[model samples]
Target: MNIKSILAKPFAKTVVAKIYRQSNNAVKVQQNLMQKLLSQAAHTAFGKDHNFSEIKSYEDFKKEVPICDYEALKPYVERVVNGEKDVLWKGQPLYFAKTSGTTSGIKYIPLTKESMPTHISGAKNALLHYIDETQNADFLGGKMIFLQGSPELGDTNGIKTGRLSGISAHYVPKYLMKNRLPSWETNCIEDWETKVEAVIDETIHENMTLIGGIPSWVQMYFERIVERTGKKVGEVFPNFNLFVYGGVNYEPYRNKFEDLIGRKVDAIELYPASEGFISYQDSQDENGMLLLVNNGIFYEFIPSEEFFDENPTRISIANVEVGVNYVIILNTNAGLWGYNIGDTVEFVSLNPPRIVVTGRIKHFISAFGEHVIGKEVERAINSQTENTSISINEFTVAPQITPVAGLPYHEWFIEFENEPEDLMVFAQKIDESLQQQNTYYFDLISGKVLQPLKITVIEKGGFNNYMKSVGKLGGQNKVPRLSNDRKIADELSKFQQK
Candidate 1:
């Protein structure tokens, strides 16, 4: 056995054991974690204000602290950004992860010394768990390229600020630095196009075994490598075996990636946010990702159907049922209490609770009251594509509310690497598939309340160009897949017209 494999054996075994133990006692583990977080922050201003001392259990805590979004906690976050110590967490945060806001301009999320480990440790344990399950520690024997944002951090008051990936880049372990690709100079390039070229130039000939990044950006790298080397990904990196990805759905890009690599490879999905690393794919035998119960973040679930209600019921891990979509609420050691990160997930397993990211709370199509979500749209596309020979690159759906003289309809903007031979038939298949998945959507179409879905084949690179124009081309930035309004659709229309 290789040295890397030998060294990993103990760590991997421990991680697998912890996962198994925690899964069996998930409710108890979550309860203990929740108490620990609350007690840790009890002396802080937020804690005092929320009467954390008086809170003894999940019920007491929920009643004491109100569920909040970024806007609701913006004031406390601003205080932290302005050099206030112990305003949220116990001390000044080590850094602020600046995330793009949906309604607001920019959100500065605090990352403390206590919370940083949740991100790093969760990631390390994810790979360790994978290694344990597959007994494939040989991946540790080869280089792994992490396509991350620039490591050059900007300052917000006294605290450092940058994208989460950029912040994480600074913390790459010293041992792995030798195997990590792309010099610091290359990561700091800022412009994705330039950085991608730099990455391709630096690692085209390296003995790479793993590639980790968002699917779209990594696909961009693969496309460039293919164009430059005139070889499939397998030929360029003979040892490449694992693809680790998150931040967006991987279904649409799966076929395209397999084609580029010239064969199928193992993939691991992660559910990480600027807030924390929530979950990761542990067992290939399981369909859903295992929840990080022992992580520093404490979790609660509010059913998606009741999310907009004035006072929705919040259920703890003990009460969460399988197959119900829930908006996740968090109370973290970073000093966030009852914060809603706007993402939605559905529990697929209850024993060792596992979840699937269903969609964003704000990212849905319900303009005409037929509430279609990201999962539905992705499922429709995947189902239809499976029956055809075409490959999808990227796609987004938005309701076209304004029609010259007909019923309103949903408009799809798609970028295809291989265009379908029968575009009209492909569009019809998608419409039919969507109808089958969502009863409300089917009713809208069947009753002639809404027109059939319209497909617009965007020129190749249109989505990338649009993202670049808007300064969100890479590093956890993704094109919103479904929207009730035409903001993204109209913007994409301009690109299509060109």
Candidate 2:
């Protein structure tokens, strides 16, 4: 073993052990974190406004602070944007993670000095956990690539601002600098296609051992490598054994990914957002990621089914139950209190608070009173494709309420890498799986209120073309897995197979 690998083993073990111990007392750790956050921010504008000084317990907190999406919190965020110190948190934010929002044109999420370390440490510990379990620190000895946004920062009201991934680029540990690939110059290229080409040119022949990115973007990179060298990714980088990914479910893309790599490789899932790094996979044998309870954030959950109801039941980690989908809320050291980041999750293990991200609160199809979430559709597609030759490049679902003919149905736009022999049979299988998982959907189909879901073949590069048309071609942007309306489906119609 090389020097880095040798050193990494001990460090990895230490971190993993620390995480295990902290997770064992998850509720207490979160309660303590909540107190710390309230006490530290008590004098701030938001804290004072919410009577943070009088809030002695979680119940008091819930009664004092109302849940806030970006619009609800915009007034305070505006003050922070105009360079107000102690407006939200204790002092001026270190950086603003600029992200595109649906209703709000551009969102500026603060990254305070206290909360920034959690983002870096969360990713670091995920790998360390893998190393501790598998004794596979050998990857640390070879080149690593994280396909991310440009590290370029732009000023927003005198605060350094960039995409969350770009901000994270500035914090890559010194130890990994030697092994990190795609030279700094290549990473700074703004155009994703250009950046990918440059990244290929820079690291195509290097001893790359790990690759990380959103599944769709990484698929493009893998295809580029194969096109350029007429070799599978595994052949190009024999040591590349780990793929770290986030932002979307990886199961639907697994068959295509393994096909491109030419073998099965280990992967780590991360639940991160501009707001905070909430969880990371801690074990290869586990079903979900370990929640960061002791991190500088306190969490709340509103049952997903009741999320739209008036006065939803919001509970702490201590009250969460396994298998129940809940919309996650955050109160972070960054000064975001009772913040709704929109992601929904389900606890797989409540003892140590391991969670699987189910879907986004807004990213679902309930057009026919049958709520089909991202997780359900992803599960349905994967259920059909597993152990089969069928592999898809990418897909999205939308409600076809008023079709040219026949009853209303869910339309699935799919870009197939390897199409199944019988398209109708494949669609039937996926539809059946989806129905089984969602009782409402099953009832609707049985009642003749909706027809079976239809699959529309999207020609190669269709999704990318659609993303490009909207100026979100790459870097941290992903197509929502499902939509209630036909906005995306209408745009994708031109690319559909004849």
Candidate 3:
């Protein structure tokens, strides 16, 4: 066995056993974690302001700290940026994860020493779990690539700042250094199109065994590889067997991905954000990611339906129920208090606290009082297209309030690899599936308030073109599956078929 795999086997055994123990006692562990976080930060600036010392329970916490998005927390973040110590966390943040925000412009999320290791360990444990289950560690000996942001960091105030993926680039385990590619020079290229070309140049002949990234960007890389070699990815790298992805759902792109690789491969999903590494897929046989309950963050949930209410019903992780959609909130060791990162989730298995990301709280179609989420659209399309030759490249949904004729409808803009034989039939099937899942949508259609959803075909390369036009072409940028407004739909109209 290779050195990495040999060391991994025993380590995986020990860690997996510990994980089982922790998960079996999830409620107790989470409660303990919450207390620990409160104790640790009880002396910080934010702690004093919020009266964290007197808060002895989750109820007290909810009353003490108001739930906040980046904007709400911006005042404290501004203090941190001005070189204030012990403001958010205990000391100066180790790094600021710089991300573009729509309304707020540039946002800088804190990453402290206390919370950084979880990001690395979360990813590591996922791979170890896969190895433990499948006894397949052969990929360790071959090159692995994670198509990420430019590793070249910029300075903000006195702290290093970059994309979360870029910040993570500096923390790759020493053991995998020899097997990781492309080189630092290629990784530091600022422009994405240039970087992809450099990556292709550097690793075209390497035995690439594993590929990781957001599926859309990785698909671009894979397409370039195929174009260069005139062969499927599997033909070029026969041992490439694992695809690890996050940031967006992979179901819509699965058929196209498998087609590009010329075969099916094992895949792992991760739930990560600039705020923290929340969860990772723990088993190849499982459908959902195992929530990292014992990690450095304490989680809270609010029912998605009540999210915009004046006083939403906030509950601790202990009270979360299966099959209910929730907007996840974070109170982390990094000093974020009652932070809402905006993603929604649904618990599928509460035994070990496994969850499927349902959608974003703000990213949905609620026009006409039909609260249609990303998961519904994804499920609708996947159910109809599965086992058929109709493969979607990308798609998004938006409400069409004022059609030239007839009632308003939900418009699906799809970029297809292979169009269905009957477009009307395909649209009907998806609309039927959606109606069955969402009662509000069903009522709208049944009551003649809205017409059945319509499909608008986007020309090939249209989505990519739109992304490029927005200057968010690659690396963690993904099109929201559905939106309440026509902002994206109006932009995509430029590429729609006549």
Q: Among these predicted structures, which one has the highest lDDT?
A: 2
> Model 3 — which ten-residue stretch has the worst lDDT?
1-10
Tens-place lDDT per residue, model 1, 187-208, is: 8998889999999999998989
Writing each residue's lDDT as its tens digit, candidate 3 over 1-498 gives 678878878888889889878887888998899889988888899999999899888889889999999999999999998899999889899999999888788999999999899889889888988888888888898999999998888888889999999999999999899999989999988778888999999888999999999999999999999999999999999999999999898898999999999999999998889999999999989879999988898999999999999999999888999999999999998889999999999999888899999999999998889999999999999998888889988999999999999999999999998899999999999999999999999999999999999999999889999999998888889999989999999999999977
Per-candidate TM equals 0.97, 0.99, 0.99
Q: Give the poorly placed runs of model 2, Cα more than 4 Å off.
A: none
lDDT for 411 in candidate 3 is 98
Query: Any runs in candidate 1 off by more than 4 Å, and if so which?
Result: none
Q: Provide the RMSD of all predictions against the true structure, rounded to 1 decimal.
A: 1.4, 0.8, 0.9
Which lDDT value does model 3 have at 478?
Answer: 94
**Superposed model 3: Cα runs more than 4 Å off:** none
The global C-alpha lDDT for each of the candidates, from Candidate 1 onward, is: 0.89, 0.93, 0.92
* Candidate 1 TM-score versus the reference: 0.97
